[model samples]
Target: MVLILIAMQFYSPTKNISPGNHTQIFIKETNPSPNLKALFETSCYDCHSNNTVYPWYNNIAPISYWIDSHVKDRKKNLNFSVWQNYSLDKKDHLLDEIEKMVVQAEMPLTEYTYLHGNSKITDKEVVEIIAWVKQTRIIYQLGKQPK
Candidate 1:
């Protein structure tokens, strides 16, 4: 077990670092309020964005793999950095999912909040996030409608 653990340390998963302002389009297009932007950066960006601020534990073997898997899965589901690539219907669906997830306290993953307490969403923050998501969904839905 010890030997396997040591070997695992030598092979780290590729980090999710992007070269430039990958999320710039998303931020500019969404036009979230300052507080909302801050909330997203603090609570949602780590796994949902192209850039991740890795935790110290991420350097450890199996833990690193676990974190990598989570980040990959999150990006697969909704990558804010690639927001511009999604269709209007997809954007609206994503916004609806975001609202549902925030309302149900199913986001920022429990494990994530455990390691980063500040990432935990408060009741007020949840309400604010859901409201913003709903507003955003309206815009997407309008875009999806026939002219």
Candidate 2:
């Protein structure tokens, strides 16, 4: 049991780090709304952004590993931290997906919410996020790339 427990500790995940300044530049260029920015930072940034604010307990092995997996999966699906890198069409599609996920209450991952209770998405907040995502997508569709 002791050995097994020790082995489990090694399974913890590590936090993500920014790959480059390009992602920062991307966010600066896009200029998301204050509300949208707060929503993303609070709910999505940990996994989807280039800069992850790791909690102290994340230093543990098994938990850290799991968190790392979540972050990897999030980035694979849609990395808002690196948004500017995507083509306008791709970003628009991603925003549509974001709206869909938020509307369906399928975001911020349940496992995440269990620990970070405050990260839970409220229905009203979901509506706000979805609306913003749709608006952004429309902006993209209209050929209004963020300056």
Candidate 3:
């Protein structure tokens, strides 16, 4: 059993960190205010960004797998790290989805906040994020050329 446990350490999932330019974050193109960037980085970047600053314990097994699964699931749902890949229409749609998710307190998955208390989005941060999303979506919508 000890050997099995030791070997399991080698099975840790790939870390999500990256050194590439943040071409994926579409909102960056809009030149978000500095405050907005800070808010997003603090409250949303861990699981949403391409570069995750993994915790030390993330090197452990089982726990690493679980964390990886959550990250993968979230990235599939809304990868802010790959935001630029989305079309304007898609961006607007995603913004709408974000607003709904924030309003309902479904974001920053509970399990995540249990460890990284800072990951929890406060009401003020929620309001700010939603407002920014709405503003950006309006820009995307208005910029759409007539079909």
Candidate 4:
């Protein structure tokens, strides 16, 4: 088991590091308030964005793979770094999902908060995020409507 573990360390998954300001377009387009932006950077950006601030344990084998898997899955679901690429309809749907996830406390996954306590989303933050998602959804929906 020890040798296997050691071998695993040699094959680390590719890190999700993007060059330049990947979130810039998302920030400008979404126009979230400063507080909301801070909340997002603190709680959601790690897995949901192109850039991830890896924890110390991420250097370990198997654990690195697990963390990388989670990050990939999250980015697959909703990558804020590529937000500007989504269609209006997709944006509206994602906003709806965000609101639902926040209200249900299904985001900032428990495992994430366990390791990074500061990443935990408080009840107040949930309310704020949900409200912002609803407001943002309206904008996306408006854009979807034909002139």
Candidate 5:
């Protein structure tokens, strides 16, 4: 078992790092307030966006694999890094989902918060996120997508 664990450390999934402002488009379109944007950078972007600020444990064996899978699944659900690819309707729906998840405290996952103490969103932050989502959805609903 020791040998197997050691061997697992030899391999790791590719890191998810992108150059420049990968989420600029998403920010331009959604326009989250400064505080809300900071919340996303610290609490949410790691998994939900293409850029991830990997933790030290990520250098370990199975933990690295686990984080990779978790990030992949989250990106599949909503990759703010690729937000421009989503249609207006899809963006609206995703924003709706974001509101639901945050309000229910299902986001930034409990296990994630354990390791990332600061990632835990306060009730006030959740309320702010919900408000931001509501405001952003208005742009999509009105078909006022900026080019």
Candidate 6:
């Protein structure tokens, strides 16, 4: 078992790193305030975006695989890196879901916060995100989003 674990360390899962600003388009379209953008980067981007700031533990075997799986599932659900590719309606829907998850404290998953305590969003921040979501959706509703 020990040798197998040691061997596993040699084959870490492929990381989700993107060159340049993977979220540049998304940031341009959504127009989050500086504070909100910081919130998303610190709290929401690790798993939900193409670039993840992997922790040191991720160098280990099963933990790397587990973290990779979460990133895959989250990006599939709502990859901010590809926000530009989504239709306006999809953007609105995802914004709603983002508000709901944050409001319910279901995001920045506890398992994630357990390791990344600084990434946890507080209730006050949730309120701020909710407001930001409502305000941002209006741009989509107006049908004059940025190109």
- For each candidate in turn, the TM-score is 0.95, 0.79, 0.87, 0.95, 0.94, 0.92
Candidate with top lDDT is 5
TM-score of candidate 6 on Cα atoms, chains taken together:
0.92
Task: Give one digit per residue, the lDDT tens place, for model 3 in 16-57.
Answer: 888975533565565566776776676677787787778889
Q: Rank the candidates by TM-score, best first.
A: 1, 4, 5, 6, 3, 2
Of the two candidates 2 and 3, the one with more favorable TM-score, higher being better, is 3
Q: Ten consecutive residues with minimal summed lDDT in candidate 1?
A: 128-137
lDDT comparison, 1 vs 3, better candidate: 1
lDDT of 1 by residue, 29-128 (tens): 7778888888888899899999998988899989999989999999999999999999999988888888889888898789889989988889988888
Candidate 2 has a TM-score of 0.79
| Per-structure clash totals for the candidates | 0, 7, 0, 0, 0, 0
Worst lDDT 10-window in candidate 4? 125-134
lDDT to native, each model? 0.89, 0.75, 0.78, 0.88, 0.91, 0.90
Off by over 4 Å in 2: 1-14, 19-31, 144-147
Off by over 4 Å in 1: none
Which pairs of residues have clashing backbones in candidate 4?
Answer: none
Where does the lowest 10-residue lDDT sum fall in candidate 3? 22-31
Clashing pairs in 2: 11-61, 12-61, 12-62, 12-64, 12-65, 13-64, 13-65
As a whole number from 0 to 100, the lDDT of residue 143 in candidate 2 is 83
**Which parts of model 5 have CA positions greater than 4 angstroms off?**
144-147
